[model samples]
Target: MSSAKRILLTTISASPRENVNYQFNNQVAIASQAPVALIKLLPIHELPDKVIILCTQKLYDEQYETVRNLLLEYYDQILCNTLNQRPDVTEVRIPDGRTVEELWQILEAVLHSIPHNCELTLDVTHGYRSFPFLYFTAALFLKALRGVQIKAVYYAMLESEETEKPIIDLSLLLDMVEWFYATRIFHHTGQASPLCELLRPLETPPAGVTGKDNAPYQLVKSIRRALENVSAAYAQALPLELGREAEQLLRRITQPIPRHMEQKVPLATELFGSISSFAGSFALPATRQRRIRIKEVELNLSELTRQSSIIDSYLKQGYVNYALGMIREWMVSCAMWNQMAEESIYRVDWWIGHKRFETEHKFAVLARTAYKADGNTTRDIITPEQRWLASKWQFFSDKRNQLAHHGFRYEYVLHSPQQIDEIRAQWEELKSFVSSKPHWNLEIKRGQGTLLLSPLGLSKGLLFSALHHIRPDEVFVVTSEESAISIEEITNRADWSGRKYVYKMKEPFTGFAEAKTISRELQNYILKSDRIIANITGGTTAMQYVIQQVTQDLRLTGIETEIIAIVDRRTPAEQVETPYVPGEIIYIEGQGRLNPPPND
Candidate 1:
C-alpha cells in the first residue's frame, strides 16, 4: 500500500498587478487571507504537507522568491512566529513551453514531482500558454497510472476589469468527464455500473428528497433507471427488452427539465442535453419500428437495426465473443423477418402471432441446413441465397461454441494456423451483414424434427453416418456391457450436439431377451419428437430385434418411425482402413400412431 498526502500544485508568473483588493467571493473557504496571491491562496487554504510551484527560467528568477517569502511570513508572523512548521515548499523548473517537446518536458516535470495517490489540487492561475492543457493531460494520466484523486482545480480570471477578480472552480468539469467515460463504456461493452455510481454520488440523495414534489430527484432517478435498464438489456442480448427500455429512456430524456435544476445540481440541463444526444443516437425509436406480422413472428426493422448496432459497437471495441454469440441470434431473427409474403402476411400489424419460439427454432434449423441441403432434400424450405449466407457462418458457429465453453472438451488447444484469417474474413462479411437488412425468401412452415436411435456395436461409422446425414434433434443409444467403450469411440469422432438417451442391455446378443421388458423400458421415456430414425446398422441380432420392437411400440403412440440400415460401400479392407467414414443409408418406413397423416 502506497501512502498519499494532501498536495497542491501551482505555477508562478511575473504579472505586474501584484497589490489589489482580492476579496474571496465563493462559498468555499479556499483561502484564509482575502487579499492573498492566486497561487498562494490554495497553499494557505489547504496547508498541505507539500506545495509544488512550477516555474520557467524568468519566473524563477523574478517571481519565485516573492511567493516563497509570503508563505514563510504566514507561519512566522501570523501563526505565533513558528517558521519551522511551514509546509515543505519545492520549486520544479520546467521549459519555456514554446514547442511541443518543451510542453512534454513541463508535463513530465509535474508528473515526476507529484507523488502517488495524493489528494491533488491544481492551481491554473499562472503558467505558460500550453501549461493548462498539458496539466490536464498529466492529471488524466496520473489518475489512471498513479491513483491520484483530483480534489479541486482553481482558475483566477484576471481578465476582469474590476479590482476584485473571481476565482472559478473548474473541478465540476472533471466529474462531467466521468460521464463521457460512462456512456462510452456502456456503448462499447454493454456496461452501466459507472453511470450508476455517477447518478447517485452519495449513498442517498442529499436531505429532503422524498416524493414527486422533488422533481429533479425523481427525474434523476428515472434517468438512471432508464439508462441502466437499456445497458443491461443489451448485455443480456435481449432484443425485445433492449428496444423497450431504449425507447422509454428516450422519452424520459427528451422531457422538459426544471429551470432551477442547474442551481441545485451543477450543469443539470447541460448534463441532460449531453445524455439526450447520446440516447437519441444509440437507443431512440427502438420500439417504434413498423412491425410486420407473419404467421407466427412479428418483425421490426428498426429493432433489428438497433440490435445490429449494439453488436457492431461491441465488435469495434474488440469484444469478439459477445459479437459472435449475438450474430447467430441476429441471423435467426433476420430469417424470421425474411418470411414476409406479398399479400399473405399482414404488414405493420403489431399484434404478435402464435408459435414464435417453435417457429424460430424451425427457422434456425432451416437457415443452418437449408443452404447446404439439396432443395429436394429440404422440401424446398431453404433458399439458394440463404444457403450462401449459412455457408459463410459455418465455422463461426463452431468458433462461438469453442469460445463459449472455453474449449474444455477439446483434445488440444483450440487454435489453427489459418483460424484468425478465417475469422477476419468472417468479420468483414458480418460487417456487411449488420449494415443491411436481412433478406431471405423463406416461407416458414413447421417441419418435423429428427430423432436418431441406434445400437452400439463393433462399427462406429454406422452411427456417425446416420447422425451426420439425419442431423437429429434427439438421440437414443442402446448399449450393452461389452459395447460401452464403443459409445465413447463413436462420440470421440462424431460432433453430435443434441440431447441423447442411452440404455444398457446386459446381454446384447442373448436370444432369451424379453420383448415386453424392452418395450416397457423404452415406453417409460416419453417421446416428444414426432419423427424417429432407428438406425438398425449396429449391435447383434437380439439387440436389433429389441430396437425394432421398441419402434413398433412407439408407432402405437402416434410417433412416426423410420427404420434405416447403413450398407458400407467400401470393401472389408477399405472398411478396416477407414472405419470412421460413412456409407449409404437405406430408409425403411415404419408407421406410428396417426400424426395427422403427414399431409392431412
Candidate 2:
C-alpha cells in the first residue's frame, strides 16, 4: 500500500556506457503513469522523481569519477537542453561486492538509506555476478523485515547495438522465487493461502501488455480469479469444487515455451503446474470413488511421511519454527482424521474456523463424538487406546492452539521426547486408520495387481504421470547405473519414501540381447502381477522396442497387458486443444496411438 516509490536504485559497475546511454526505446507507459521521456531517461518509471547510484568502494575509487564526468557532460549537452532541470542523482558508497557477506552488507547499507515505508524500484542492469542476486534478496528482506514494497525490477538487456533495448520488468521472476517457497509450504501443509498470495499480483495485467494476443494477460487474470475461487471453496469445505476449479485453471493458465522475448515465464509455469496438479488431484475421502479413495489415501500417506521427514530435517538443522509448524499441522491432521468418519475429511474450514465451535473446544467435541459415535451404548465405546489418544490429542491441541494464536517462544515451547513420541503415535494411528481400507492396502502393498514397466531415459515426467494416474504395484525402471540414480531421486522426492518396489534393471538392458535377458526377469514379475501396463514413453529406442515386444509376446501367451504413452502437444496441428501440459495419457494400440513422443 505504500505507493510513493520516489527513488530508483542502480548499481555502478565496470561498463557504465549503458548506464548513461541506454534509453528506454520502444518503452510502453508504466502502471505508475510516469512520463515516457522520464521513463526513457531512468528506465524504471516507478522510481519517478529521483535516482540513487550505489557505488562500491572498488568502483568509486577506480571508475566512479570518470563515469560521473561522462554523465555530467551528457547531461550538459543533451539532457539540459531538453529537460527542465538535471535529474536528482546522488552517489552513495558501500563495501566491495567481492563476497556474499560483503554484498549483503552493501545491500543493507543501501536499504537503510531508504525510508522505511517507501516502495522500491530496483535496477539490476549492471552488476557483478552476485550483485543482481544480492539486490533481489535485499528486496525480499526489506519487504519482510521492514515492510518495504518492491514496485518493480527493471533490467535493460544491452547486448546488441542495433536492436532497441526496452526495459524488461523481472518482477514476476522474483515472485517466482516466492512462489517456489509457497509451493513447498503448500506441499507441507496443504494450505491455499500461499497460493493465493502468489496469484494476487495478477489481478491486474502487468505493464505494457495489450492488443491482440492478449491470451497471457487474460489467462493470468482468469487463473488468479480461479485460485481465489479455490481459496473460497476451501473455506466453504467444498473439495470437489476446489479440485474442479483448479483443473479448469490449469488448462486456462498453462503456456508453452514462448516464441517472443516477452512471452516466456518458465518459473511461473512450472510453479502453476505443480500447485494445480496438487490441488486438482486432491479429494475428500467421502466424495471420491473407491479407486480414487485408494489414490487419495496413498497420496495423503506419502505427504504425511514426507512432512514428518521434513520435520526431522528441520529439527536437525535447528529450524524450530519450521518444525513447530510441521508438527502443529500434523496434530491438526490427526485430529481431523479422528473425525473423518463423520465425513469431515474435506472440511478444512471446520478445523480452521467453524462459527459454532472454537479451536480448543472443537477438538474435545470431535474427540468425544468420534469415539462415541458407534451405536453401542451398553459398553464404553472409548477403548484404552482411544482414551490415550484423546489425552494426547488434548495436549497437542492446546499447544497447537497456543502456537497459532500466540507466537513461537522457543524457551517456553514443549520439545520433550514424550511429545515427540505422542506426535509419532498419532501419525501411526492415522496411518493405520486410513490403511485399514481394502483398496488402500491393496495398491500400496508390495507385489499387487498392476505392474507398470517404464524404460527410464531422460524425461521423468512420463514416469511421474504413470505413478500418479496408475497406482502400479511396482515400477520397473530400465536404465543404466547413472540414470538409475537420477530416477531414484525423482521417485523419492515424489513422496515414494522408503519404497523398495521401484526396481532398477540390474542387467545392462541397453541392447537387444541384454534387454531379452531382463525381459525374462520381468516375465516372472509380470506373471505375479494381475495386470501389466507398459509405459512406452521413455528410454532408448532399443529399450522401448524390447518392452513393447516383450509385453506383446506375453499377451500372446494369454497375459493381460496394455501399452500407454504420454504426449505433450505444443503445436496446434497435434490436436484441437492440449490438456494438463503432457496432453493426456492415451492407450497405444499399434501405430494409431503412437504419435512421436518427446524424448526424455
Candidate 3:
C-alpha cells in the first residue's frame, strides 16, 4: 500500500556502438515526466542539466585541458537552453583503485555543490556494470537524500556477442531489495530485449496460489531473461571452439601411425570395430556419427582419408552424445529431488495410511506368503495380519494420486515454498490424528482358528468380539448362497468341539414375489430365534435382493432384530435393485447398532 518513492532510468555501454542510440531514445521515452541525469566517462560539449561527467584519473591526465573546455561548453549550452530552469551539470574524477564507497563519497561531494532545488536523476546505462552499480548506488542515495526523490535509469543489452553476460543471482538480489523499494515497473523493448520475451505473463501460479503483488513473478522473469541472454551468447561463440576441441581429441586418438604397419585392411577394420563398440557403449546412433563426420571433416584423395574421417566422425558424435546424456541425467535427478522436496513439504502422509502403506504391505505380505506357501527355505518376513493391514492401507492409493497428481493444480500452490511448508504441517497434523486412534490387533492361535476383519467387513466383527469378551454365546449363520458345508462346519470343528450353530439357506426364487415370501419367513425366524448369523456373499444381485425383502418384512411387522453379516472376504458390489421402504433397524451389524441398552 506504500507509494513509490523513486524512479530509475539507466543506459549502459562498454564502448561506442549502434545499440546506444536505441538505448538513449528508450530511456528518454520511459522517463519523460522525470528529470533525467546522464553519467558518462566521456566529456561532451553539450549536456543536460542533471548530467554528471565521470572521468577516470587516466582520462583526466591524458585529456585534462580538452575535457575542461568541453565541460565549459556543455555548461554554457545547458544555461542557454533553459532561461529559468537550467540543469546542474558537473564534471568529476576519482583516483584509481578507489573503493565504491570512496567513489560514492566524491560523487556525493559533487552533488552537494549543486543548488538545493535540483533533484538528482541518475542515468546508469553509460557506467561500468551499470545494472549492479546503479542498484547499489541507488540504495545509498536513498539513504543520504532522505526526502528527495531519486530517479535512476538502467539499460542493458538483450544479447552481446562481444563479451560474456554477467550472471546475477536474483535470490540474493531479492533479499537486498525487498525492503528498499515500494514498487518497480519493468519496461522491455520487445524485439531487442531477451528480458521481454522471457518475462511474459503466465496463465497461473506455477506452484501455489500467488497474489498479484508477489515478487517471484518479477524476479523469475528477470532471471529467465538473464539466462536466455547467457545461453544465446554462449551458443554463438562456442560451436567452433567445441568443434576444434573435438578435432584435437580425435587427433590424439588416431594421428600416430606406426612405421612398421603393414596390415592396412585389418587395421582399418579393427578401427571401425572399435568405433562401433564405443558408439554402442555410449548409446550413440551410428547414423548420427556418419552425419557429423560428413559435416565437420574434409575428405581428400589421401590414403588415410576414409579411415581418419570415420574415426573423426565417431569422436565428434560421441562428444555430442555424451553431453546430451549428462544433461538428461541431470534433469532427471533434478526432477526427482524436486518431487521429493514437494512430498516432504506437503506432508503427504494422508497417503501413508490410505495407499502407501497398503500397497507396500500387500506386496510384502504377498511375497512372504508366496514364499512360505511354496515351501521355500526363505524366512517369513511378513504375516497374514500384515497382509490385511496392507489391504486397508492400499485404499489410500486413490487418495495418494489425488494428493500427488492433481492436488497442486486444483487445491494448492506448487510455487510458493511457504505454502508448501504449511501443507506439510497440515499433513503432520493428520498423521498425529491417526496416531492417536487405537488400532485393532489380530492374533491367530493354533487351536483357536483365524478371524479376518477389515474397514469394510470388520465393523460387525469388532462389536461382536467386544460382545463375546463380555458374554459367551454360540454363533449361527443364515445365508442366501448354497454351500456344501456351512457356518456349522466351523462350529462343529475340533477347535469349537461341541459349540452349537444353525445354518439356513434361503431357497432360490425366479421372481420378486417368491423372493419376498422367503425373505419374510427368514425375518420371522430371525425375530423368534435367540441368535442369528448371516453370510452376505456373491455380488449385488444376491445381497441387495435378500436385504431388500428382509428389511421390508421387518418394517411391516414392526419387529426389532439384529442382523450381522459374516464373510470371509470383501469386495466392492453395486446396488442392482431398489429395496422396499422400511423403518431404520435397531441394530445393523458391521455398520453399528442403532440403539442399545446402556448396561449392554
TM-scores for the candidates = 0.62, 0.44, 0.24
| Span of ten consecutive residues with least summed lDDT in model 2 | 438-447
Question: Residue 499 lDDT in model 2?
Answer: 31
Better of 1 and 3 by lDDT: 1
Candidate 2 regions off by >4 Å? 1-3, 13-23, 27-48, 61-86, 99-101, 125-127, 147-172, 189-194, 197-222, 229-265, 285-421, 433-600
Clash pairs, candidate 1, are: 371-387, 555-592, 555-593, 558-593
Candidate lDDT scores, in order, read 0.64, 0.55, 0.33
Residue-by-residue lDDT tens digits, candidate 3, 1-600: 224322222222223333222223323212111112222221232233444555456545554445345444544664575553434434466433257786566456444533432343444434444334534555445444644434333333335553322211222232234212311111111111322332344212356646764444444444344334423322332332233333323332243333222121124334423432322221211233534433332211121222223223322333222222222222222222223333353332322234333333323333333333433321233345433433333322333344445354565423255633443343233223222112112111112211211011112232232223212233333333543143333233212322333323344333334445445334213322333333233223443355555544433333333443433232222111211111122234433332232344
Q: Relative to the unseen true structure, what is the C-alpha lDDT of residue 261 in candidate 1, on a scale of 0 to 100?
A: 41
RMSD of 3: 22.8
| Model 2 lDDT, full chain set | 0.55
Q: Identify the candidate with maximal TM-score.
A: 1
Q: Where in model 3 is the C-alpha error above 4 Å? A: 1-49, 55-69, 75-84, 91-93, 98-379, 382-600
Tens-digit lDDT string for candidate 1 (1-600): 224687778886576464544434442323322223544444444556677888788878987777777766665654474454666777999888888888888888989998888988787877766777877888888886898988878777777786576777787777667667766676556677887777764324567767765776677678788888877877776555665676778777677764444543456566666555545545534344445111222455665676677666666666567777877677656655556554634454322333334334444444445543543545454455556565655556777777778768645535564765566577666546542434343332335566678887766777777766676776788877677667656665666667777777777778436555665544323334557778887878877887788776555434457888878888878876787786777777754222121122
Q: Rank the candidates by lDDT, best first.
A: 1, 2, 3
Ranking by TM-score: 1, 2, 3
